[model samples]
Target: MTQVLGIVDIVWRGRNIPVEKGAKFRLGGIKNTAVTYGRKVGRAQEFQGSEVMATTELEAGQRWGNTWDPGEGELQVVCDTGQTFVMYDAFLEGDIPEITGGEGGKIELKWAASAPEEIGV
Candidate 1:
């Protein structure tokens, strides 16, 4: 079966926290960043099957190693899910970014894949 996936854009607002040596630290939101992409599969699915079919990652945004100085305020991120998230610690080097808001933070993600082309065998 063939299927088409629609592209999605996300937007949110929150705070950015800085961490040292993997230890959590508190920081108020003073930065602004954004991420955008297409539909993606959930990470939990990886355990469901031996061979992973669909996988996607985040791109076109700030990286983890790259230091961001939001500069005296708070930080917020807008995602495709339509839920605004306040970032606590941004792990840019990994496959995803860890964000927090209100009670706590969760991982935010985006993904995309090209439609396969058919060729006569």
Candidate 2:
């Protein structure tokens, strides 16, 4: 079966974090930014995925992403075929959780990256 850019394994700042199976991740053009809409790829009959990403937790030394902070870090979306869509200097947009809901309290996270690099599996 040919992979069609579904099922993403996220690698934020080199840390691997896999999202829900129904999660839908998309990357924009060079001028545009990358965004991951939680919690599903498209609207069919699926619930949104929780645990979209890691957020604020100082004591845990876990504050390198989400929060829309600029750490010049990398946000990688590893595809099912092992193809990785890496974004350098990626930072979450201030107003995340754009959806704030989608019938089941689902949300959307927007991210901005300088340039995106796609690697083959």
Candidate 3:
């Protein structure tokens, strides 16, 4: 089964926009091996009963003005290699600068073979 390695929350700032919770979000891997966009995309590729390690969760809420703050929640996701990544409570809008603006964040993950013994098990 796939397992999650790490989760990092992200916040992208747009013209006249605030980083809020529950906003449309997407995630991709550094290896360019996996890429997910839109809610539909995320839902289509959610974790499948895998016991993966997650450090943080997705945030929730809405923007009222120029600023938005997404609280935090798990991003139900299964890595390309049967691993699941469920981010917990941190913002990760620094990985994808093109999408999340110049600021980037990341959610690190690894397969059972590549993961550290402390996390991969």
Q: Which residue pairs in candidate 2 have backbone atoms (N, alpha carbon, C) closer than 3 angstroms, thus clashing?
A: 24-40, 24-41, 39-49
The numbered model that scores best in lDDT is 2
lDDT of 2 at 33: 33
Model 2 spans > 4 angstroms off: 1-3, 30-70, 96-108
TM-score leaderboard ranking: 2, 3, 1
Write model 3 residue lDDT over 16-72, tens digit each, in one string: 122233322233322322456765333234332222222222224532332223332
Q: Report every candidate's CA lDDT.
A: 0.28, 0.53, 0.29
Q: Model 3, 65: alpha-carbon shift in Å?
A: 12
Cα lDDT of candidate 3 equals: 0.29
Q: What lDDT does candidate 1 reach at residue 113?
A: 17
TM-score of each: 0.17, 0.50, 0.21
What TM-score, to 2 decimals, does candidate 1 have? 0.17
Query: RMSD in Å for candidate 2, one decimal?
Result: 12.6
lDDT of 1 by residue, 1-121 (tens): 6433232222112323222122221223233434344664333211110110111232346453333233222223322334333333333332444454443333333222122122222
